[model samples]
Target: MITTLLVANRGEIARRIFRTARAMGLATVAVYSDADADAPHVREADQAVRLGPAAARESYLNVEAVLAAARATGADAIHPGYGFLSENAAFAEVVTAEGLTWVGPPPAAIRAMGLKDAAKALMIAAGVPVTPGYHGESQDPAHLAREAGSIGYPILIKAVAGGGGKGMRKVERPADFTEALGAAKREAAAAFGDDRVLLETYVARPRHIEVQVFGDAHGQVVHLFERDCSLQRRHQKVIEEAPAPGMSDEVRQAVCAAAVRAARAVDYVGAGTVEFIADASAGLRADRIWFMEMNTRLQVEHPVTEAVTGQDLVEWQLRVAGGEPLPLTQDEITLNGWAMEARLYAENPAAGFLPSIGELEHFVLPESVRVDTGVEAGGAVSPHYDPMIAKLIAHGPSRRVAAHRLAAACAQVQVWPVRTNAGFLARCLEDADFLQGEVDTGFIAARLDALAGALAPSDQVLAAAAQGLLSQTPVPAAEPQGPWSALTGFRINGPRQGQVRLYRDGQAVTAPLVDGPLSADVLLNQAGAIVVFEAGEAFAFTGSPPQAITGEGPAGDGVVIAPMPGKVVAVAVSAGDKVLKGQTLVTLEAMKMEHALTAAFEGVVETISVAAGDQVSEGVVLARLTPSA
Candidate 1:
């Protein structure tokens, strides 16, 4: 029996595993990085160990450090929660060799599905439906290019060892193939240490569907239906749902059967996911589904699967690791309801979704839905790891009801100090197309402008602010006789303004507070809101804030600036270089993503404030462009 288990990962997954382990009367241990010393997961564990510095490579990715941590904690087993090294076959091998129970699939299974190319070949041999692509061992650039041409234009160059869209590129035309290939190769090499890539025919309007399959030492495998992860941005899933909206009974059976076959092909002995890309433009058809890749570990969106299936996957993982046979049969397992999960990220929706980093001042979510969060109030969102704040999941009798409930929960959340995707996610759930289940990979991309536009602060927000202010005991009409009251100055018939600045969407606005008993008017130049207090502290707003003042205020001279913290990746112009309006100026790499800072008007580069390698903070002057004379 596994008495003590050490999770070799951090954040929500670690906490999630610990929750299940503890419930099963197993001791739990947590490993944290320098930045996560006081993290919630670290505090929740029975014991905690420090791995190393904040950088993932020095901490979570260091195999030796993790092994040492497990050993030092006297942990009898190691559970590699998804992400850091969960699918690393070598890590699993080391754990078992060291006489530690590995709470995951066998290392051989991981090795078989570790690389996409090899996995595709194995799946084909197992009689599973594989996509038409070049999954060979050829690394010759010219030969690969020729293969891509033969496959046809608009081929997808994907790294064999890639996941999470890191080493993937969609080349729409032959003219752009070379550059896309080079970029994908470079990214693949950096991320996976393997530069080999494969080309596949690009499917337009593809719906990403995957089956959750589990196996045990008893040679039994059962699938938990399917999840539709079609709503994506930059190949990263933003929303996921179970029992795909438009799936037919025949296609669902085929997908589930194929997933089980793929798992059986590798002698799998734990939880795994078999992903498929379906051509949804023609609706759900068995012939239209093709295998994409298999995820060797639990997925981030597993909560939705659990909610709908009413199962704890972590417990199953632990049980399988303990050499137990499959406890449940296919007929015994059943899906009860529709479930949806939305990833709430600390990011700016209007600013190309750049990851936002800061302390979570006030993080409050409604109790109507289940929220699995890694960070808590006052927790810092560092740049060292992914900036996901939480995963909000909702379950209902129907998909539409679940989606709507999840959206309402997200909008009701009040988070400050860091910009979040809550507003944007709420808008997406309320979107007509999304509500109708007409979703695809291009959903977000096609409706980005409308989504961003919906992030504008609503009148309800202004009313909330007013209510917050009104809740405070009415500032004495006349100066009170206490030290706390000294700060409140009173003058008859003389108006005094208290300036309060609040940040929204990366821009700070100073609202002049005009104090009154029943009402307060917050004015900022011409854009102001008259907040009327009702029912003691409630407030009602009259008009919307001006749109022109939403962006950065005048900087005394003609210059736009980088509005958030990031690293400069490109400097498109030198001093005295002439540029056109909306010309690309500098590309800032932040939160492991790239964003281009463009010129606001036709101008000349008067002063280059930063270089390519410089790290910048919010409101930093990156480059000054002088308007044309």
Candidate 2:
């Protein structure tokens, strides 16, 4: 039995694992980099050890550093909390070789299911259904293009070595295949160090469903039902729920049974997920479902499953790793209620979901839900890691109640300075199609405009901002001050209604406020104020001196700047080159994704400021353009 545990990851997931370990009376150890020395996870652990710099490769991904920390801390086991090196076979093997408990699936199973192509072959041999695709060893561009032609149009190119939509692209036409393939290969090589890819027939309207299966050394393998992760943007899950809606009894049984068969075939022990893609074009059917891939580690969306089933999966992992039998039989485990989770990320939705990095300034969550986060009100959101702020989970006896409650909670959350996707998530929950169980992988893509569009501040929101600004100014004890004091709208003649111009997201709004006693319900901090009104979310605003602001540079200035702090991965333009509007000029990579900076208007390149492989800061000009002569 293990008495001490070391977590081999960082951020919220690491903090989550430590919560269970501390509750179970086990001494917990946390590994962090220089960037996370002041992080919440470090404070939560009983002990922490510094690995190295902020770059993941130098710290969390360094297997030797993690192992050394475990040894130094005298930890008896290591729990890799679902990212970085969690699914690495060599890491697991080394842990077991060193006589430490590996709190995950066996190394053999991880290796077998590491690559998408090899895993599909293994699943096929195990009699599990798979999607139609070319998962061959040949990776020649010409050969793959030929295979794609034979397979048909509208195909998906995916990285065989990684998941999370890193190296995935959808080609809708033959003319775009080459470009898509090159992008997929580049991303795959950067993320997984493997440039190999696979081609698969695209499912137009697909529901992404996966089964949660657990096994122990006693030869007992049982499934914990299914979760629907179809609500996604850019192939990354935005929202997830347990017990897929519209699932029939027959289809559920068939899918779960197949998942069990796949797990047992690999002699899997511990928690694993068997993901499937169901063709929901005509609604869900057992015959229309096919295997996509298997994740040999605990998933990020595991909390919803726990909420519906009343089980702590982390506890199960601990016990199973200590040679315990399955806690419950297949027939004993049953789902009780509906659960939903919304991932709150630090991103600006109106700016094409570009990540926003800065101090959190203020962080508050509703009391009605379960919130898992690793940052506090004064914490910093660094550019060196993923920008997810928290996971808000809600559970109710029915799906409708759960969905509505979760949506309200998402909207009620208040995070300042660093913007979030809270409003965007609320729109998705309130959407008519989503509430009616009409979700699919393509649902977000189809309705992105309606869901993530720029939100205009309402009249009430503007009024609240005005009220907050007035409340901050001090009232004079002596009457009859200078005219400058009247800026507060403190006119002695009758009720004075004055306007205040507030700028938000680069737009200005003028709000009218009446001179009166301020309300005591306003919440304020050094950075801003949050005013709560009737039936509306607490409006967060910061007071700015009145001025006419021009959001653009001076006339004739056409400079392309980096949107975020990232490494310059590619530069496609040079000085003296004519460019068209919206043409890709450079690609900046941050948070494990690439973002292309495009030309704002047609012009000639005046100068190039940066080159490929150079690290650049946010708003640094990469290229400048002038009108063609």
Predicted model with the maximum lDDT: 2
| TM-score of each model, paired residue for residue | 0.84, 0.93
RMSD of each: 6.9, 3.7
**Candidate 2 worst ten-residue window by lDDT:** 529-538
TM-score of 1: 0.84
Q: Residue 626 CA error for candidate 2 (Å)?
A: 2.9
Tell me model 2's lDDT, rounded to 2 decimals.
0.86
- Compose the digit string of candidate 1's lDDT tens values, residues 1-629: 89999999988888889999999999999999999999999999999999999878899999999899889989999999988899999999999999999999999999899899999999999989888989888888889889998999889999899588877999988788886786677667756889889999999889999999999999999998999999998998999999899888888999999999999999999899999999899788899899999998999999889998899999999999999987689998899889999998888777678787888755666789998889988888888778787889999999999998998887766665567788788888899999888989999999999885434344434434443443443322222346544443454677653433344433544334445442322222212323322111112232223355454444335565776677776677899999898777887766655566788888788888998779888788777777888
- Candidate models: Cα lDDT each: 0.81, 0.86
- Which residue pairs in candidate 2 have backbone atoms (N, alpha carbon, C) closer than 3 angstroms, thus clashing? none
Q: Write the per-residue lDDT of candidate 2 for residues 1-629, one digit (tens) a residue.
A: 98999999988899899999988999999999998899999999999999999999999999899999999999999999987999999999999998999999999999898899999999999999999989999999999999999889899999999798889999998898998898789889888989899999999899999999999999999999999999998889999999999998899999999999999989999999999999998999999999998999999999999999999999999999989998899999999899999999989887899998999766777778999888888888889988887999999998888999999888777877777888888889988999999999988889888888776667666666677766685322122555664565556667865566665544555766655554323456565544433222335554553356545353237877778899987788898889998888888889888888888888898888999899998878788888765
Tell me the deviation in Å of residue 253 in model 1.
Answer: 0.6
Off by over 4 Å in 1: 463-589, 596-629
